[model samples]
Target: MELSSFLLAVIEDLGADLDPPTRYTRYVNALVAALPGNACALLKMEGKALKPLAVHGLTPDSLGRRFELSEHPRLNAIVTYRGVTHFPNKSTLPDPYDGLLEGVHAGDLNVHDCMGCALHVNGKLWGAITLDSLRAGVFDARVERAMAMFARLGEAVVNVAGLSESAAAWRPDTLNVKDLGMLEAVQLARHDMIGDSDAMHTLKREIQTVSRSQLAVLVHGETGVGKELVAQALHAMSDRANLPLVVINCAALPDQLIESELFGHVKGAFSGADNNRQGKFEMANGGTLFLDEVGELSASAQAKLLRVLQSGQVQRVGSDREHQVDVRIVAASNRDLAAEVKAGRFRADLYHRLCVYPLHIPPLRERGDDVVLLAGYFLEQNRSRLGLRNLRLGRGCEAALKHYSWPGNVRELEHTLGRAALKARRDGLGAMVTVELEHLDLLSELPTQACAVINSVNNAARMSMPMGEVSYREAIDGFSKNLIQRVLVETQGNRAAAARQLGLDSGNFHRMLKRLELL
Candidate 1:
């Protein structure tokens, strides 16, 4: 591929009206055509980390991994140097993409050629573009000059893409030391929400739009779908970012103590009220109060919360004096509050108040390749924790991860990768540990014995029903009850193990048991 051809291709792409992600992807593709390497990546610097925005000839999971300057010396060198820095074949610095290149093993990268240049737009340091080849002496003087020219084109591409609303909304700024740690924490919270799928892109746009408004947001998602992370991002991107973010887990509090917990209690107010205390509302006076599992609030608790939200005031349990506090509300729930309202389990008024701006997070199964990307993120954490030089998915593992239905969503994927990494480490795959498919504990696909039990129970449930016709809902409930009981009996009443075997969250399974009157 020639430089002239690359320029012509970029111009053609720019002339077409495309989304920011698609535009950036086309730009990387063009860069790969003009560069002299098997792999090319366009990374954007965020605080002290470099995030891959687009890549060519690299594994899909590479987009999920963040390269920190303190961890990857080669990237640090590329970002700090002005000119194109080409590393010798014997350079001591380790490659961040070890075991990450498509169809290339970590062992094959011992003496590969690498070169990169820091990109700039409007005279400010934007990010970096890197190119790598598995063979030595691939990045010669001519290729170096070509990289420099392509780097300039990369800047122009970013400049054109930055005009879009989505790209302009999330442009990262260079931060100092004081803000870096805070930014890192915020980034970690944003990590789980990473994906280029249409569902994710819509959620992100909705977040950006609602974060600036003061209306209450109700985040709805399945268990392990990261509702809390969505709340964190909402608060962080809101006007109240610098203020405190108070979190209250509604399900964790007892029915008898929920009022005192939210409204605070005076001395001798109740059995354990020995000292003056401040409740969650007062503590979050000028900030955001995150109510996790808002559907679990008791009837009495719901009335008190509604009063406070209506009046912007809270009255202590033992005192009549009401204190005024301005607090923003961001509530999250795994259960369908609308369904709960219809069933009379949750208050309809309170539901309406909390759901002013409803934000729904897509389940993991709906996000196609995001599973692999998130797997890479967790694998990186495990690699650092287990003291392995590199951790990556082996042959067919990516397919296994992407094809299976993630019932528990991101949380289950995190746990699955952690366990797989440990198992692979125990197998002594040396410094470059490759997690194979067998190491994954994917419970969505049950064993033959378990399947047989489920089948038998389902048939028995149907046959035992009365002769009269029944609704589909009733039939499903009967089968579900029998299946839960069978699993419980098989596990010897270990609810956690039973839930695992049935591919359900423990809390969800417990709720099912209660609903079916099997508790």
Candidate 2:
């Protein structure tokens, strides 16, 4: 067949009516089959594996498992060296896929000759197309010429078809855009929280399911995972968005003042109560009140707070009158409320109440490839923020963020990218805005912030935990305790404000703080 005819056929096949998502795969299969042979294959690269995108005349299950490029010396050789290698007889070359080759031979297709070409897009290796025939030595000079033309045409079609990124790691059918940029992903706000890995998807689904309710939610996760964002999302998407989203930091305030801050105090209620002040509850009336580091609330405070949640009423200090407040409570704490309850540090009833709905946000390290999406978002956001339009992450920055365990979660990433963009913009003197990963070096600084936090004793001591391999559940509890203690200090024991800042439910935050014995 003439090269032009083959090109036209392939082009037309791609443009034909098919499922919008799978059209490219269909085109690749059709192009590979047009060769004058019974066995033809088209493969696209995704991560470490070169996936068989389209196949025909080979066997029934030709596209089952992906062909690892590292295992296929011939294919790998072609892909690695950027050249197409052909041999008329199988015996002439070292066969990399020994078992696969034998299976093909058993199928009664004696490869007298074969021709294959590397598919290139953006001048880089994208994948390969191979045609096998039963006629020995049939792939003559003419066949090679035809294969070359097919490869060239295939390159254009592949590029235009938008399959240049390869089909394995980047299956658009599987890649929902919403999941990609989900920094604080949960099903309620957006759905595309993409990670096939068990841990990630589990967290994503849990967040989605838990997001539907107004019940006080307790989010337990590591420091960097976006807990507060989850709380904000809950409030923003819930029936309470139109009202105030009030935040308080239990750890940020003095222990004695917590009750007054949450329930509000009338003038002359206590020392320095010179004027009447509406507390967070009053401020957040008919809205969502987020109590972050909630475990830091004192026992007396917890009892009073529980009554308010249970009764939907609050009595101001120095006032006998109780006011009705319609507020949805969301609480977050980086502490183990159960442990606090056992230790007599937290109220069990409050813990149960706050845990009516729970959301756990995963850290950046567990988001898999979502790191790249978030990095891009941060990079762009920072670029605009710093007034540096050309600033972008270099290859190293991109790869570093992907591999780096973001201990601080989304906030850390945003800060790092913003700082890096600024540094890059300044260093380049406007010559280069593409930032290298010097900022990622900040990853090592995560532990420095994790020193001995004030425990329930309000005394500094390294937190004690069971030593040895632990489960995700255990890790979450420990991290929560550590984070609650730390955020309380950072936010100065103000639960409501801290909850807002950390994107967590204030009530749940209080529960965890209580459980962790912070109260």
Candidate 3:
């Protein structure tokens, strides 16, 4: 094929955002007029080294095929001069490009015959492209010109990427969320919450780091120890606070409508997309997009999301024209992404990028001083919130609060405090509010356990043996043991609290603990 057509094809490929693996060989073949005797290569600047970008002529057995940029004068000169550098005589060349190369020769590849061009775009050195031949004089004027042109094409492609970013900066989202990592307490704290525990301090610091960068952040925690609260704090402190902080519950959204909700659709895109619609990206254009329970996203949805994040562009469900968007993503999940990745249920790359800075909210039971501090803050807030006159936790109640293993984390605490406060505010009955949570009931969790027990009973009843006579007590005990073990893990080995939560007195709890061999 003619060298011009080859170079043109190379330009087209680069325009397609060519992947790294084959980009070098394709460019080398297109630029070198006559094929080099064996293998040829293109090396580019990376950190402190000029690593091989593409290798073609390396022996099926040649060692040290990769050459270092700093160690090699040829590649270094390419980075330094920001122009084409050729062999010994440049005075005989057609004309001066950057006039970069005067008397340079590539000695590191140690190949006797080769030329290289430095890739620069908007005055910055991006990389270099080299066209080498085993035979001397193989790269003629036509070949040299094509190499230079295609190098410019590579630069042009990078320039286009730069343009996309610049355009994103001017768009509503990028400009608004100037600092997506900030964790300012003023914007987030509804009441004065004073907690100097290590957990709280670490959380605050993470909030600050996430506030400064526009990257995906993953917030992980058990069922509500303030995971969503942390996400809200992120949004409130970020530059996008003024814009919509759109929150989507991936767990709640149905699979069928999730795509339409997230990416929007044209009129008639689906059965119910009657009118043209804008998706979450468009809605969250000028702000932070918070996705709760993101781990619940379907596999297909994860791929589409991965594409949007990778490209910074989104196409509506039905439409073909992809809208360029600038959206900062902050996702929260209760599941372990590492496990998900291992299970092949989640993309590894997406997991790393999303967890660029992971902030794991400590459960209430594990927050050290934050537990008391946050509980007090919630108490007062609930007081005003529910119009309670005067209610307080009794000495025993305070001890119970501190002693019980809060399995549901902050959500459980919130529910407990809110209900306790409401009960203490009895007016018509004229009942004096006592601090003793004797009425706290601590027994609401039984309905769930009872439901499980009922199911077990029904399954056992199918055996045709007299119901309740054949003691499946062992099975029930095993189930309880498993539940206890899981709760112990969640509570980090607070045995007393775990026993109290199981509704056992200290003596009975000890016996059960001994039976379970869980001293």
Judged by lDDT, which candidate is best?
1
Candidate 3: tens digits of C-alpha lDDT, residues 102-164: 111112222345677777777867677665443556556655665567677767654554555
Q: Which segments of candidate 3 are over 4 A away from where they belong? A: 1-194, 426-432, 443-519
What would the TM-score be for candidate 1 when compared with the true structure?
0.79
Q: What is the TM-score of each candidate against the true structure?
A: 0.79, 0.50, 0.49
Compared with the true structure, what per-residue lDDT tens digits does model 1 show for residues 106-204?
Answer: 567777889999998899888999999888998899889878888887888887776563444454432222233333466664567766565676777
**Sort order, lDDT high to low:** 1, 2, 3
Q: On a 0 to 100 scale, what is the lDDT of residue 128 in model 1?
A: 96
Between candidates 1 and 2, the TM-score winner: 1
Q: Which ten residues in a row have the lowest lDDT in candidate 1?
A: 173-182
Q: Write the per-residue lDDT of candidate 2 for residues 1-519, one digit (tens) a residue.
A: 655665777777655544432554555555555556646767776555565555554321234334446545566766665455676676554332221221222223334566578888897788888776666777777667767777776676667556432342255334233332233333223222323334455665555455446667887776656666666766655666577889888779786887788888999998899999898999999888888888888888788889998999988889999999988878888777778899999999999999887776666665544555555445545544665423444323433554455667766776777777777777764323556546456434433222222122112111222232442223445666766666778888888776654434344456556757877
Worst 10 residues of 3 by lDDT: 95-104
Among these predictions, the greatest TM-score belongs to 1
Model 3 per-residue lDDT at 71: 35
In model 1, the runs with Cα more than 4 Å from the true position are 11-18, 165-185, 443-519
